[model samples]
Target chain A: MKLISVNDLSLQIEGYFAFKHVAFSLSQNEIIGINGDNGSGKTQLLEAIVSNKTPDSGTIDYTPGVRIGYLPQENPQVIEQSTGKYLEEMRRLSKKLAVRKDQLQAMITYMGLSPYLDTPVNQLSLGLKRQVDFLSAVAGHPNVLVLDEPFAFQSEKTIQRMLDLIIDLKNNNSGIILSATQFDKRIATNFDQLYLLDGDLKNIAAEQKNEPVSLLVFHVSPNSMAITPDVEDFLVSNQDNQIELEVPLKKRQIILNKMVQLNYQFEGMRKIEN
Target chain B: MKIRILLKSYLQLYFQNFLYLTMLFSIIAFELLANHLLEIGNLKKFSLLLIAMFILSLFSTMNLYYNDSRQNKYLKQKINSHWADWSSQLLVAVITNLFSSILIFIFSLLLRDNVLVDFVGILGLFSVGFLGSGIATLFQTQWYDHSTVGQIGVLLFIYLAFSGSVVNILTAVEWLLPPLSKIIMTLQVTSSITKLLPIVGQTLLYAMILFFISGLVYKKNRKNA
Candidate 1:
């Protein structure tokens, strides 16, 4: 059964179309991965799926009475309260939804959140905050789980445990929707379906495909509007504050040197084909 | 069940914050110190002083309701009911204010100052507390990060309230506000229970309307965010 279906969706941010006419669906026991570059509207699309964001135009139909759990990318504004109390609140809400969280306590211990349970959520490290959010989402045993960058800021062992828990949820017939910058081998191997959200959602093969390309992400000073270096040929996309360039593998070093010579602050460089 | 959980979370958050704890205790301290210094001789003066303290404390702590994107997003995703999170916070605000009123009433009772008059004063305190919190919630929900605008709105409300008495023309426009002036007038002009009942009803009615409007505005703003 289709747990959720988003059709002809359009979302605009800061008066620019983040994505237009996007469409997708999820079914029971299915796990879908949405891959995109930074600021490609991956998070926005996940939020829309969970009904946290309103689409500019479209319909996101959900199966009646299907409970959803969402993990936001950050929790800087979370209310000041002990982590234990926060988790207790989520547990109560889960009970209200009629979901049994028998293993949830054990999971909390396993995640190393036990010692800091009395600590305030805001005082916790960034990685721990994200784990708290992940646990909150899992406690509900939601019919649909929407996680944005769930694997971020975690150790190898923690990431493995999270992946195990997610797979277990899938075994129990929970559908999952998650977004990531890129799918590593482990992710590509486990994910049942993969969608590339460049400008719209497109179903891509599960395996990571390599192309002869590299991505150059750079930041320009907010006050400066002009790039002193002439690299229009390599420019893939440019926004007011950042620019992305698609460079050939052989020319990547030349482009980096030129940008460094011109004093442009390079944010990151990643191989497009990995 | 959802409301209870949300209410508990909000209250826990409020009580845990050092600033919120300071504001709440400061209200109590101010009541004790001011009562001793002013030598409140009657029920009316005592109640007025207590209610003024309540309003001040409420205004000071209401900034906690300023729009927080992260917390709002978390609640919006976790809670099933749309109004549960907002209504829960408003309930917490009212409950804390009520706590101050009850403490004041108990003190008045212990002092053995005309039980009937003290009861009436407590009733008046309830109405104003609701009115003040309602107006503040309306502004907070309607404006994102509403510190500046909320301050301006509060100043305007205070002006309209006091001006209604000094300037005869402003009395006609006073009815549109949360009936703070009316509550004060009723407590001051007549201790008659009948006159006070109608004012209580009017204040509660205005508060309910403001709450309803705040809910609507909250939903709209949440969607836009």
Candidate 2:
């Protein structure tokens, strides 16, 4: 299902262009990773789509009655609310986007947030509060999940869990748009589509990108390299007088055939250990 | 149901933060009763107590209105954020201010107070409170962006409006905001509110307009949020 379509969106603040001539459409069961450097307007683009910022010109059409959940990049300014009440109040405000109690409990348990549920939000560490913000956005099971740096200020394990959560939501037909300044191979690989927003939203086609399977590094010795069965099963890279072999998962045989067909020479077969 | 949820949750928060004003009012009320320096009759004293509560309520209500958004943003992130938008925040102002005002009035009434004034005074205070909340809510939303500037502007306006007759200068344009006119009249001369109906009518009218306009601000903010 087409969740939202943005057309020719443009916004400027303080006479500086935040974004211009940006357009994108989101559909169900898709995870779109927006990549950019700081001040490159990744967050601004998400804001435009999430309805937080009005554009100077453009139209945003959402399929009628679509629910959205957003987690901002900053820790939400919370003073008096406990983590539990914070989530509950946000859930209430989002009427018709009901999330059952058990589901919240499950996420809480998984995040080890059970102990901090009743803790005042401001009093929690930044990372804990960030998780609360994450839950507030994801708990309602929104049709469109807009996460801006949701994994920031957290552990690697938590990041993995959040990535899995996005996948789970996608499998359930939710459209997820994630804005991340930093890149991770696993996360980048998981995105159905990647976009680099630098004033303009540019699509990084999925097929043109390769997921790293294996990295094989070796020393190149001027035509003294020997191509053997062991050395043939990898991709070859010649850089700075050194040759590195990269082996794509399950394509080692094809790489071997390519090396043999090309009459490629290598010093020795190597697989870099992690 | 949604409003109920937001109201209830915010009310809980209000009760917590409202302690500052409640304690302030309680201390002042007790000192007045203990020192025996107030020479007025019991009714006047009780009325004065309610007025004090109302004033404190106004201060705290403004504080709540300003801090609610500054402090928490969970509701702001939700899809249907109207529950915690400026209008709803103003509703919290109304509810908390009224709650404290009425509670003080009733509690003071239980004390021995002879020679009671008519309901006009209470009605006048109530209308003033409604007006105060309305204006405060407006400041909390529209003027809130420029914190220091807005606070200074509002304080100046409130002082000029209540102390002198600046509202009268703006009265020709006041019909658009009838509440300010009513507030001016009510504060200028307490006896003027004896008729009561016009005051109440203007209170409702002004409150509706403020809420409606602030509601638009909410929609606009949500659109850009």
Candidate 3:
């Protein structure tokens, strides 16, 4: 069943165009990864889904009784109070979800935040604060999770823990939509559905099953490259190069090897798999 | 449930700021000492002091609410929690005013050698002032930038309508039709308002009216929210 459906949705921010006629659906237990370059309306799309921004024109249909949880790219200001108080408050607000008070404490512990529970949030590191905010959103046990840049500023272990939490939520029949610039291969391997926004307001359609994927695109500097992959493909580009290559989805190791062998200073890489 | 959660969180925040609480207590103590040294027994003086306390408490509550609103987690979770928005503001106003009143009551008994009558009067003033302030905050939150002017205007109109003798001229000329005119007239005089209605009754009435008005404003704001 589709938990969230957005049809012909468009949004504009500060008179600058953000998204246009964007359409997508999130099914039960499906994890949809949204990949795009910076300023590609990835965050705006996530915000629109959570009702933070009203679409300029379109229809958004959400499943009744299905809660939507969003973690924005920018960390919210930390309350000058202790982490425990923050988590307790979140737990109280989400009390209708059958979450036990101890579970909240456990989640804090799992995030390596147990010792910091009594410490003021403002005193914590930026990464720790982000973790706290992330836990708060998931603690509500939302049926549809919308996470924006969950790995930003997070350590590898913390990212792994967050991934585990997402998998756990998925096992509980919850759907997840994540947007990030750099796509973790583990996440792409685990999550099948993918959407790409290519410096435009709309989502670029995925490549067909029978077609041979286009591997590279040559364009002027600053123009976003396009990828037509049969499945999901990873792209690793040189820092000075203008052309972008589409690495086979399963051969990320090979792409990494090629980049290293070519001695090309890489800008960034992401996986587009669905 | 959301209100309960917000209330709990607010109280926790209050406790966390122990230094602020200490400073607040010291200020209250200094005021009580000043009042005792002046030997002022007039109701007007007492009412003015009560008003000052009310403003102080309201300022503190607003500070806390703004702080909580800045919290990313709180704002994210609370936007969907209907109870959090209304009840948090209401609880802050009510609780802070009640605490201030209680402190004043205790101070009056200890320093002024006043009877239970003065204690009750102070309680009534606190209650009415709390309700009025709560209603003001509700308006302020809903209207955002214009709340300050709007609240001041509303309070000024209420005071003028209730106490201004000019109201009688309008009534005599049959030029103005006012609701609650009789009640305002009855309570226009301080002695009658304090004497006829017990402090509890006056406070309850004020609280009820303010709460009702706030409820209406909140309903309208929630639709916009």
Candidate 4:
């Protein structure tokens, strides 16, 4: 069943169109990813879907009595209360939104935030704050989840746990909408559908029908240039000493061998389809 | 049910701020210093306390409004109504200010024995608090983007409410402001119900209108939040 449908959405920020002529639908047990750079209206589009923002022109229809859980990109200005207190208050006020107590408790333990329950949310590290916000949103066993940049400050282990939790929620028939600049292979591959938000919603799969490519990330010493993979590799990112390349499947093993021969440190590699 | 939870949460946060503690202590300290050190009569002391209460309540209410605006986007989504979110915080501000006003009233009574005047002081303080919260809501929600303009407007309103009578040129426009001056005057001059009712009623009516207008403004503007 369609959980929510947005038709011809147009949102303007400061008299400029954030995103216009956007259309999409989310269904039960489906996960949709919105990829966009900064200021591409990803946050604004998500906010409109979650009812935190109003679009200049469009209609967003949700299933009757459908409950929504949203994780905003930023924290509220003043978080004077302890994390535990805030979460408890949110739980107490769930009201029409049902709380998944056991699930939430388990998530807290899994995220390793048990010791910081008494700590003020404002005092928490960026990563921990994001975790707390995520848990608060997940407290309700909502029918739909609207997450904006959920993995921005998360550690790899915590990101994996969150992905596992997302999968679990999907198995329980929850529809999810996630917005991010880019998704790691583990996350992107799991997306049932993907849309690129660049002034409009464009289906990524429909735009590119090519097979998945292998992504190799490694750190090379400045002197090791015996066999560069530039001949058959598309560089995805090069930050710090590490480089991420989208190489053809046929050249994946050759590049790995060349890196091994050149004494380059292998960080990680995976197949990605975008 | 949700509003109650939100109110309780907001109150807990409201009392925990160092500013609130300072404000509370200052109220007591001012009452003490004014009653003990100053060789003024009960009427003058009572007047000073009322003015202090009005200023403190205005700033205190503004402080709460600031805190509420920070989380308003998140809370508005939770409650699914701008009216509920705005009102819950307003109630918190009013309740907190009322507590302090009552405390100051009791402290003054202990220092001096003017029961009738002190009782009228409580009503004046309540009106001050309601009007302050109304103005704070108006600024925080509707005029948030134009904060400088809003701040100037608030300063002008305060100036008019307190010294508008002295500035006789603005006499014709007194009706447009909260009936704070009238309430202060009526509180001091007479102790008769017949005399107090009309002024107090005017103050309450003005406050109610301000609150109603601010609420509508908030509901209208918060859509773009």
- Please tell me what DockQ candidate 4 reaches: 0.46
lDDT of 2 by residue, B1-225 (tens): 456555654565556566646665684566446336656544445435534543564465566665566544545445354634554566776766556555554454433242233354455455556656665665665334557755874575456434442445665755554354344444444443345457566765666676676577657755554
Identify the candidate with maximal lDDT: 4
Give per-residue CA lDDT, model 3, range B79-188, as digits (tens). 56554656676776677677777676566443344455555556654664474455455445523435576567556534542444345555663212212223334344
Per-residue CA lDDT of model 3 for A1-274, tens digit only, reads: 8899989887787887787777788989889888888998998888878876667888899989878777888765546668898778766666678357887777778889998989998898889888987887887788998899998998889998888888888988899999988576556767757677764433333443332433443333443333333212444343444546665555545654554444443455554443
Colliding pairs, model 2: A52-B224, A52-B225, A53-B224, A53-B225, A54-B224
- The local lDDT score (0 to 100) that residue A167 gets in candidate 1 is 84
- lDDT values for all models: 0.72, 0.65, 0.64, 0.75
**What is the DockQ for all candidates, taken in turn?**
0.38, 0.34, 0.39, 0.46
Could you tally the backbone clashes for each prediction?
A: 0, 5, 3, 0
Q: Candidate 3: DockQ?
A: 0.39
Residue lDDT tens for model 4, B1-225: 677757765775566566776976887887777756888766656666667766777777677666665655585576676566667866876687678778877777543355655455676666677777666656663235667867887887787778755567877887886666766665467644235546656766776677787788767766555
Q: Pick the candidate with the highest TM-score.
A: 4
Q: Which regions of candidate 2 are displaced past 4 Å?
A: A79-97, A206-274, B8-58, B72-74, B77-91, B102-123, B144-225
lDDT for predicted candidate 2 compared with the true structure: 0.65
TM-score of each: 0.74, 0.71, 0.72, 0.80
Q: What is the lDDT of residue B58 in candidate 1?
A: 49
Q: Which stretches of candidate 4 lie over 4 Å from their true place?
A: A211-274, B12-28, B35-39, B107-117, B142-156, B163-176, B187-198, B220-225
Q: Name the top DockQ candidate.
A: 4
- The TM-score of predicted model 1 comes to 0.74
